[model samples]
Target: MIRGPVIETPRLILRPPLAEDLDGFCELMADEDAAKFIGGLQPRAAVWRTLCMMSGAWSIRGFSMFSVIEKSTGNWIGRLGPWQPEGWPGTEVGWGLLTLAQGRGYAAEGASAAMDYAVDSLGFTEIIHCIDPKNAPSIKLAERLGSRKLGEAVAPAPIPHTVWDVYGQTADTWRARRLE
Candidate 1:
């Protein structure tokens, strides 16, 4: 098993995906609205594949989305962090959370820490978030993270028909922003 880093913020714990996280991950992806931007509603079997994919990525590439846990409740809330799947647009620090976890500023808090890890530890000089064009909430969050709209790009094979508005910042820019 991949022993990934355990990152703690004020209210959340970010760690690698585990077998036990399946239930919460399924719950999050089953909700229409919550899963809409991340991906359409996924069935249990598909969610299982996704969970395995994340785990496999950790084993194969040494990094993948972290299974997010709410510190106070210790509940598996969602997953978010470094992600660079095959045919990806760029090195990314993406996020997806359970519905109840939204509107809580948790994405920003968690994403900041993930971005730090990707840059400082993983040597990623640039980080991007590939967001759907209509995902205003995500667009807002990306902006909040100091990522500016870079341009649009067609999504990879599985979603090639979909075009995304890419937003990002270089490590130098990210570091400069952090000092402010």
Candidate 2:
């Protein structure tokens, strides 16, 4: 079994999704607000498929989305980690917070922590956050995390939409963040 990386923030724990996380994951994806940029509410089967995909990431690429949990409440909040959509520029750092978890900086915290792990520990030199143009909050989060706008590109067919690439910590940028 391929075990994924675990990251801890001051208020959360990021780990691989367990079988028990399936239901909560479904609920999160079913939320309209959380689903804004993520197409729409997914069927239960789709959520299961996503969980399987996440598991496969560990097996195939040695990394995948980390299930976000509130440290205090110990509740599953959402997910954040490295993902590679075919035809993207590089490994894409992404995050999604449930409706109750929104506006609390959890998304940013999870995303930033994952970015650190990707570059510093995993030796990833290139990372990007692909955000839909209309998702202003996500776009702002990308910028706040020190990502430079890398222009736009049309994603694949099903998602035939243009998204802006938010560049994360490259080797040089990672080095710079360390100095500051």
Candidate 3:
């Protein structure tokens, strides 16, 4: 089994999903607004499957999104990190935070840490964030992270999403951004 690493940020802890995180994960996945960009509201059963898929990824792929926990409240606030499944467009570091966790810069903080791990530890040469064009907030965050719109691509089927805006930067650029 893959031993997921614990990544600590200034105000968040990025770790593998635990069984206790089911409630928080389900709650976020159930929120229409919060789940809109990622995927529309999912049933509890679907969320359970997703949780299982995420945890399974660590064992099967040796990497997956890290569960974001608020350091102060010890809450599972979101999930963000390295993600690249079969048929995926490219290597990506993604993020999704609950509505309650919005506007706090946690997505940025957690995503930054994830990217660092991806490029430095995992030796990823490039990273991307697949975002819906209508997702202005995510677009802004991607830009803030120094990723520009590279192009558009169709997402996997059954999701009803089309022409995702792909924002990305190379590892060299990521390193330069860190030094700035």
Candidate 4:
């Protein structure tokens, strides 16, 4: 039997989301600051849907968003991993941190680990980061992942719908010459 991949960083651990994480997941995604780029705080049902979707991704795609826990405190700070949204081309690398977790560089660190796992361990060819144009921090994070702008597209959003696309990159190219 295959066990889930566990990605470790200097201060974080990215592992599969567990049932115990539902409440923490809701709180993180519901935070105003953390949810800004994601449209906004969603209803509890919406949070449940997200959890189910991530779990489904693991079973269907062999990879999914992971619960990001602070190694030192073991607190659930956020999530980061690969997901394929409807109409999207490839697996997208996404991160959502609790409001308190912002500005700590944890998102970037966790996402970098996920990207490496997607490319090196899972052999994925492409990764995308779709971010609202106004979300400058997310845009910078995408660039740090070696992704390039890919224009925008509208889709059903958590709140008022919007279109956003910050970057896309192929694993082979990024692994060879990653952006600075």
lDDT of 2 by residue, 48-137 (tens): 988987877777887888999999999999988988755656788888888899999899888878888888777788778878778888
TM-score, every prediction: 0.97, 0.90, 0.96, 0.88
Question: What global local distance difference test value does model 4 have?
Answer: 0.81
User: Residues 130-162, candidate 4, lDDT per residue (tens digit)?
Assistant: 788888888888887778897776654433567
Q: Per-residue lDDT for 1-180 in model 1, tens only?
A: 546899999999999999999999899889999999887899999999999999899989999999999999999988999999989989999999999999999999999999999999999999999999999999999999999999987888886488899999999888888779
**Which runs in model 3 stand beyond 4 Å of their true positions?**
158-161
How far off is residue 126 in model 1, in Å? 0.4
What is the model-wide C-alpha lDDT for candidate 1? 0.92
How many pairs of residues collide in model 1?
0
Descending-TM-score candidate ranking: 1, 3, 2, 4
lDDT of 3 by residue, 1-180 (tens): 325999999999999887788899999998999998887799989998888889988999989999999999999999999998776789999999999999999999999999999999989999999999999999999999999999987887655656799999999999999889
Model 2, runs deviating above 4 Å: 157-169
- To one decimal, what is the Cα RMSD in angstroms of model 1 from the true structure? 1.0
| Worst ten in a row by lDDT for model 3 | 154-163
Instruction: Report lDDT per candidate.
Output: 0.92, 0.81, 0.92, 0.81
Q: Which runs of model 4 end up more than 4 angstroms from their true locations?
A: 1-3, 156-160, 178-180
